[model samples]
Target: MDSDSHPAAAPADDKTWEELVKNVLRAEMMRRGVSYAALAERLAAFGITDNELNLRNKVSRGRFTAVFLMQVLKALEVEWVHVPASIDDAARKGGAQALAASKRQP
Candidate 1:
């Protein structure tokens, strides 16, 4: 039987993954003082257009493709750290809740 075909192991919350990746990318960019424009230019050299970068930046939740994450990591010149599945889940849930709260008007 196919592993994914089983009902017990559904997909992990994607919103969490997107949020976590976004946070990590943002933090790394900030730490290196790399502006979006600068990153855009660098990515452009690699044939990753500004529009694509913007879309990646806008992803709020979902499974982050390894290729996409690696591209960003390469642009940032950072090593990848493996995060536990539980941590990713928590981060995604927390990020989603925070985003929802921030969108609410007073």
Candidate 2:
């Protein structure tokens, strides 16, 4: 994915980490113009058979494992991923705020 298309970086803190991972995958999908069906098809070639509905649910929850992440990345042809050694204070503060706001909801 192009660097410009990335959402502002944030720390995958205790609460917001799942969302961060989910957004990263979703952004990559969006960048490749990959639909759930297309992803399902690609995975099928590797003997994985997650249907569109399952894939959608999995991506939305963002609670999948590292193996799942790799499978999706491989299927999507992601060459590499970056990991920030540290997140800046502003981004961490924003992530914390977002996580708190989410928990206070009905």
Candidate 3:
């Protein structure tokens, strides 16, 4: 109810995007009753080789590449992901910030 509690002022940083992506993937997995081992097997059907432990680590870190995200979604047979516009905007901003930061790190 208070302005300080609003997410609009949240920092659009890597951590925000990481948490968002992690939550989305985990929620999807829960929705479909899919475990890490089961997900690994499903990915194998599509020629993606990943063990349950690796999958767990990746999802836990929430720092995987977009290609990996697509692979997992495809393996899950997910047609689409429904992200709120505000969240999507924030994630995009976060991505841009990350890219900019990487560019400056050299």
Candidate 4:
């Protein structure tokens, strides 16, 4: 009876959510002109040890956790978050495919 179990429910794959979060993080980094090394340095000051390689791989693959996302945003001094009002149909299609694939497995 869960809403997500319904036939018409949209895809909510981890990959999709990760990509969504990664996109937001990248945009914020760009806006602040914060390079990987610089961001790492900022985080280090707060006792985090993220380096350029970790940042590159993590963000590029969009496989990081929500806590990491919040840390990055905090290091960037981002006081607000925003979700785009529109998304491309192509992205939605991809998410749906991923969701279907996930459901087919055990």
Deviation of model 2 at 3, angstroms: 28
TM-score for each predicted model, relative to the true structure: 0.54, 0.66, 0.70, 0.68
Q: Candidate 3 residues 1-106, lDDT tens each? A: 8866655455457787786687677766765788999999999999889999999999878899999999998888878675533554425534423322332211
Candidate 3: stretches off by over 4 Å = 1-10, 85-106
Model 1 TM: 0.54
Clashes counted in candidate 4 amount to 0
**lDDT digits (tens) for residues 1-106 of candidate 1:** 7865643333476555566666666555655677777877777778987664574455434355788777766887877443433445435545433332332222
lDDT of 4 by residue, 3-83 (tens): 666443333676665665666677677667888889999899889997899998888787877888888889999887655
- What is model 1's C-alpha RMSD? 9.6
- Give the C-alpha miss distance for residue 23 in model 4, angstroms: 1.1
Where does model 2 exceed 4 Å of error? 1-13, 83-106
Candidate that would win on lDDT: 3
For model 1, the superposed segments whose C-alpha errors exceed 4 Å read 1-12, 51-64, 82-106
Cα RMSD of all models vs. native, in order, equals: 9.6, 10.8, 12.2, 9.9
* CA lDDT for candidate 1: 0.58
Q: How many residue pairs of model 2 clash at the backbone?
A: 0
Stretch of 10 with least lDDT, candidate 1: 97-106
* Model 3 clashing residue pairs (backbone): none
CA-lDDT, candidates in order:
0.58, 0.69, 0.73, 0.67
